[model samples]
Target: MADYQETLDLSSYAALGDSFTEGLNDPGPDGQFAGWADRLAGMLAARRPDSDFRYANLAVRGRLLDQIVAEQVPQVRRIAPDLVTLCAGGNDILRPGSDPDDIAARFEAAVVELREHVDTLLICTGFDTRGVPVFGMLRGKIATYNAHLRAIADRNGCRVADLWSLRAVHDRRAWSEDRLHLSPEGHQRVALLAARALGLAVDDPEAPWPYQPTPSPADLRRENIQWAREFLLPWVGRRLRGESSGDHIEAKRPDLLPL
Candidate 1:
């Protein structure tokens, strides 16, 4: 962690993005996703129990960068949170024939707009997909987007949590069965990373994961087949029909409330 002056006064936080930020596959007891944003909020609330820590998450599943800008950004701006974390454009980059530069440009515009409303804006790079199956093909696009994000963060005053460089997220167990969203454990790790990026003191922020043995050829084949049937085909169908997982879904936590 980089050394900086310690001033952890996270009284209000707002999270904006897509399913990744919505905590897909990391289902909470109420059937809503409690992703890294929630975990980080919980931690912050814990640290300052005496303070009225509030949080609002306006992320929804399968949202494109443009959708986030149009729908979520306005709500966050209205809230005028003390801190805001934005993680979008992953869905846009995943589309067929999508241009990373175009997506990045749109993403940068959102960041510029949001940062104007809040001083502490947090951005994140997409994760590496060295081991993911079909999704691995888009690693180049993800990398390009990540590079743009770094540049945007530098030019703007936003702090970045570089998920692309986090080796732990590459583990198979870190991802859900769909290979798109992170598992609960994966969300926990990401929350730790985000907290550390915000200069919050956390225990074992750099904790290591145990090595995972490579799956046998037969096991890999079986898993791939299952994934194709369970996730890939449905995802493709949605894209073809111009539908989204979040087509009619609403934000789980739209209002800012005590965490």
Candidate 2:
């Protein structure tokens, strides 16, 4: 349990990605400071009290995969970080103008460039956006990106974190007003993931996770049914009993009642 300053230097790490990685909906530092990377840094600073691990967050709002390649990758190279954590691809999915296949390809290229300088790489698979109309294809596109990323990580022997599964559990409360951004609690959960993936212990285990209503199978199922009832069914499928748009099933969900 060395102090964070003792365990690592300020220049030891770097964070790269888009808005989710940047904490857009979060209250602190506005969009620039609200992301998972900041939460993770706070946790590490506390846990590794001796380590002065420095993390440079290069994520931007509304950045596409290509934008990351042209911007973030070069910064990573200059920093030459020991550990790199990246969460991207959501904007690519939501950008009506961009092709999914191309988005996946650009993500892969960015990862390749990142692997060159960073010793340990952590890439997020993105979230499960089953209910959002704008992100209808997000799940599939993320899967495609993860599959390719898996191959790349396997070849290079880097680490990959499945953020899709982590966030797959549905909770309207987990999302911010934007529906695209994660709430405060969501960022905390993400911090926990980053700590675990990097082999770092949480600063305060007894302290509640920064996020709430932890992602679990039961939660995911509940979210799915609610999602279907509110958006999917209302949009295209046969309308379910008492179902309506902009309204999530919130009471006594038979499917998740046991949990």
Candidate 3:
């Protein structure tokens, strides 16, 4: 790894990706999503109170790598932000018959294009799912994608926040009941990791790890049943019908605004 400059004058920040970046499941008081990108923006704002720190999030749920490249990437190029974070491909990898190599190739192309326009680029690896129940089946695919992501970042001179290596995120509590998105605490930890990856001065980067309680067999069975009924079934139904959760949804914070 190369040494990144510890200081940044981030006047403008833009985030591009899917639900993970859109802050899905991390609802705000006003019923809007407030995910890790938003949290990181807030922290950056606090760091430079005197400067005008602008941020935009152009992430929608259920977006694939192709959609992100086609739709979100152009907007970020137009914004030409001081810092940009791109986290796509997760949704694509989860789908049936998806190839990790193809995903990585598309992702690297996007990174190559984005890095040419932005001074600072940040990309993240997908989280490990070894701890998740049925989702653990995708662990190998996720690892392949993560490996490619690191290589892409290195070639593009982009920084990486290695979510796959973050042990805390493996904790079941770090995830929401849907098992797709992260909880508020999970987002917070990710935000801190992003800040640190950008070489920003962040407090409590080594925060205490979340405690994991062993669930009884009955509890596990009940939880699995609930997850299948509430989340998995709907997800499968949507896939069968070729529908998407983000079909009509627009970006939450589309325009750049002071933080």
Candidate 4:
């Protein structure tokens, strides 16, 4: 199998996955979504200015690989996309009470379905959230999921974007308020990973990731406390007061904000 760039034309591609590919919170200029897929599409568009092709992002928040297999795969088959990028299985692996075996199976199914249609397919692995509490199990599950992805892609002659390695080695301060999701900067990093894997380039490689929101520990605490005093306390005040406040803290709590 050839590399992503060598196999498909960047101008005509499609993307499929969940929130990470949709840019749920990181909306770009003119209200364009700012997920890695969108960033990559924009980059490719600029790289081939005369080539007017379309990129379809069929991703939703909280969707697992099975959903992609059931929903997005059908549409992609109809579109007959020149290239397709998939970044699923994250929500499935991270969800509470999730079954790793099921997640891997679903991922395999998605890859199989995608391969039937697109000539060049790309699979992105998940980040290493080992530092997050109760996620030790998830780390192993992600490895298993990636293994399945690789096996399926290889068998079908598709490309794999090593996003897991990139996130593992790069600075993670670029993440967003919900440590689970990426900020605009983080999305940009992801975009670069995809671009390089596909052998494309953003107009200005140095241009920022659009929106960079840095929330420190202090910011989180302030937001949490403010939320407690206003919206939360009003509805569940007495009940929350009875519970230990520490339990409400996010998994990866930033240091206490300075008053």
Lowest-sum lDDT 10-residue window in model 2: 250-259
Q: TM-score each candidate.
A: 0.95, 0.68, 0.95, 0.72
Residue-level lDDT tens digits of model 2 in 133-201:
546556677676667666766776666766766743356666765556788877776776667666664
Task: Provide the overall lDDT of each model, using Cα atoms, as 2-decimal numbers.
Answer: 0.87, 0.62, 0.89, 0.65
- Model 2 stretches astray by more than 4 angstroms: 1-11, 29-32, 167-169, 203-259
- Per residue, candidate 3 scores C-alpha lDDT tens digits across 28-146 of 76689998999999988887868689999999999989999999999876777899999999999988889999999999999988878999999999988886877799999999999
Off by over 4 Å in 4: 1-7, 133-137, 167-170, 201-259
As for lDDT, the candidate ahead, 2 or 4, is 4
lDDT of 3 at 69: 95
lDDT of 4 by residue, 78-180 (tens): 7666778888877667555777677767777777767777778888876766665345557877887777777777787777777667742244455664455
Q: Could you give me the TM-score of model 2 versus the true structure?
A: 0.68
lDDT-superior candidate, 1 or 3: 3
Worst 10 residues of 1 by lDDT: 1-10
Please report, as a residue range, the 10-residue window in candidate 4 with the lowest summed lDDT. Answer: 250-259
Candidate 3's TM-score: 0.95
Which clashing pairs does model 3 show?
A: none
Model 3, 228: alpha-carbon shift in Å? 0.8
The candidate with the higher TM-score, 3 or 4, is: 3
